[model samples]
Target: MIDNSVRTLFLLKHSPYPPMGGAPLRNWQNIKAMMQLGEVAVFSVSSYKSPRSREYPPGVSLWKDYSTGDILKERSLIRKISDRLWWMRLYGYPEADQFYGDRVAQELQRLLVEFAPNIVVFEEIWLYRYLKIIKPYGCCLIYDAHNIEKSLRRDISVSEHKPPFVSSLSGIKTAIIEGYLVQQVDQIWVCSQQEAHLLQKLYRQIPPTHIVANGVNIADYHSDRISHSLPTDGLEPNHFTAIFTATFSYYPNSVAAQILIGQIYPQLRKFYPNCRLILAGHSPTPYMKESAQEDSGIIVTGKASDIRPYLTAASVVIVPLLKGGGTRLKILEAFAAHRPVVSTTKGAEGLNVRDGEHLLIRDKVEDIVAGVCQLWSDSSLGRKLAESAYKLVQQEYSSTAVRQQVEQAVLQLLPSDFRF
Candidate 1:
């Protein structure tokens, strides 16, 4: 059923192989879906070094992979300063322009000529700057929006107590950029219906928008498939463990970690003295590490090769996110691992999960603590929630379900005579 005539190229802000974080994981899934539609070539930029060997699909090719270090190494001091200043003046942040420069543009132009892709997928709005380079090639453009950038930026800035003027300026610039990108792309893909509506509300003249919800590979997190070799240093089988997993470097996750360590865990420990909390992810801030050192009950795993073990060891998974955009994959992963979940409303945003049905949704620290304790005391309730959540994920958020959604979206972009 593959369309041999279609050539699809992905322009990503980060490398998707060995997908550890949300953005990379989403990109990885999208790539896999595209591979089913046609031949795929990826041109990605990453902050980290490329893996020596990536397990890419048989026919797919990583045409260009550049590290931020690789891109910066060749630039002179004067050029770097000029570029930063220019980007700041226009966009209020340099990230949008980070992957765009004469060198990258020329290489992209060459790629367009040689690959001659029929469809070009922009992984996120950050890569929208490269749209001009691909437009001349007359390829169908698809913008996969990971988050509603303007709204997320505004919310994060306000939560972090950034100056009002500065936050407003940044938000305005983001809206302008995102608005243009949405209009320019042939089709737009968002994480949820909530995001789709937000986009419609924000911009008047947007192209067709589709909801492509975030999902997990169910088999990866299945209890029978995972081995329980909990990676952290100190843990006993008797302890009631509450775990929160995320890329801790992200602003919302960092805030949630601080809240868990400073507020929630302390309160929960008083009720159940044997309670232990695990903050498992990459790039724990210095404060989080120090807190872990001070509290024996808290274990901070800086980065793990696999997160499945931690999920398997958990008595319950907690998400105390205060501000963030898009649906959370952490909750889905927890459900897939057959663990009960307690998430804040913001933490569980964009998911079609009901409070107390799939997972308990709580906003306040005390309430979240109570929810965790409830799960610990009543084993049957936890089992019920986990079972319901597992069923929900299988029906809607599994890899197979998401792949079908992506396939349908892509089919709509093809010519009327074309068939998949």
Candidate 2:
């Protein structure tokens, strides 16, 4: 019973067509779930040049797509700085003005007038800048909190060894912006209960919050359907392989990749000489690329179009993240692919799974290496963990589960008399 009359619009910071990384994947999944509710339109503004695809996800009407790079190229340096200064004075942060220019605002206003959406969903906190434009439209507003930005910024600063004063200021500014954004929205959608609780603790007079957990497409990552072909070189079918996949541009993932190369893999090779390490994802750092070149056993696959091949070739998936906010979608992908995972406590945050029951939870370098080696020596242990994890994904973190959550949360915001 699809309702054609219920128009819902999504405001995104990036296009989710191909969904290469976590944020885009979540956006894509959220868009798909919203399609079940009514007519859906997306307006995305990308800060960088992303690879565009002709084949978009079915059932989404792309109202407008803009690239910040293209928009700002012709603008004068003085003008850009002026805009930033003006935005900082008004909003306490210049990110909104930095990402969206006058042209973008004009076009967005035109979309609002024509589309006349019944509901407006802001994909992430960055889009909070457009709230002023959206409020007058009289549409129900939903803010999707991808992460508690303040906490995430603080974590990143600490991990990157940023100065204490700089980190504190950044955190404070983010808290002020995010705190205001949450209070303005009709309802807030968070990735986990932990995030919902954190929001409640941080902000006062916030709207109703719902936990719509991050999910993976079960069919896409099913063990039976994944290909055996390795996507990168330096690995064979017989080689014991460990894989870590993420958008390496993200500060946390980049840090984890450094730890894997600098600390984990070297120790791992001592235990298993045939061991191979693969870092598969987009925007890997130059350090990673150089290390891959220097070490024959390490393969860094940049911007994988499809990750299933790498996952299929992996003996175990590793997530040694020291700092992160949301649940790891990469872990769920590995679970759906029927691969054993070894992660730190921070890496497995927000997920409802025991350390020894679903996957090995190890924080120390020696412990992680030992866990991987134990799995290597005893195939039964890996299979047992993988089986349990696969079942967990099916029950709690699959696309179907997420869609149901989204439907329930969104429906609660609609008027009692409204029907689909």
Candidate 3:
């Protein structure tokens, strides 16, 4: 039987199930937490046209939107051209997702009437256009600000100077959209205190914003010992291994890998000649694969079914990300596995971790080299940092810890007399 009390309708940009780390993991945890408050239903867009998988929270409902192919087949050339022109004029770039079609809007409208939720929560700001449609229902609106979208785009532009014009325009478009949404929503949920402060400063008129930190399901990653794997090359078992993991589809992760292979690894190898590097994640670029072929010690494991094995096999985990926003789930995963980590300042942004205490934070080439060398050389230090990091993750970044904060934030958005 469905719970009649405190129904919430979620609008998501992507499905949370079969969590692939990053935004999906965060969304899955948030939705899981929302179920504790009351019944929840999710409406999301599929990035591709794959067979739908049913792996959501128990008792919660899910409705998926179509991929681009489904829409383009029905869309007329003139209409498409007109949309492109309109997008260019208004947002200074052609953003296809913003104005997809009436089909999605109609579907959302139908679901809204049927579900009749007391609270309508959106995962990201991209879905704000549908906000107006939910207004007549009198449900409280909540915006889960994953990251300040404008700031993220601006940061990318500053870090990687490619497509500067599009990035600048996209940043402006995001700012305009975010500014409007912040005022309209009843409350906003940010991932970190840094994000909360940034949003408040950027939009002073912003409504009550709550800090709901990103977290991991600790049980999924805890491993007692590093999994043993035979050395593929002439390298011995004693070779120091450092692993960097992330979906390479994201631009920042790819850049981070390049930096790791090109700069950080070289420096570290000078101090420890037997040091090996592992790039593990989905969709490894051609360059990454080619680089791996060039160096026998550099191993690229593209799209592993179980990242835990790859993570477990490593002596140290490194995040050399030069750009990106929000707290990193990868770092939290490493901590959950009780693995020592070395990361850049930007890589550790928004995380409740301290430099030299829980994880090593180093930005410069020399510092990163030194950090990795120290972690690999000093077994005692590695164990100490890993233990402290695991405790921190359990206490602060565990699902239970984050869910309570989420629940409180959602409760505050409801009427004082509202009951579940």
Best by TM-score: 2
Q: What is the C-alpha RMSD of each candidate to the true structure, in Å?
A: 2.5, 2.3, 3.1
Best by lDDT: 2
Q: Give the whole-model CA lDDT for all candidates, comma-separated.
A: 0.83, 0.84, 0.79
Q: Per-residue lDDT of 316-347 in model 2, one digit per residue for the tens?
A: 99999999675489899999998999999999
Superposition TM-score, candidate 3 onto the true structure: 0.90
* TM-score-superior candidate, 2 or 3: 2
Pairs that collide in candidate 2 are none
What would the per-residue lDDT of candidate 1 be over residues 81-130, giving only the tens digit for each residue? Answer: 87767535654355665666668778888888888888898887777778
Error of 3 at 90 (Å): 3.4
Model 1 residue 368 CA deviation (Å) reads 0.4
Candidate 2 wrongly placed segments (more than 4 Å): 1-4, 49-55, 74-79, 83-90, 161-163, 228-232
The per-residue C-alpha lDDT of model 3 at residue 378 equals 90
Candidate 1 is scored at a TM of 0.93
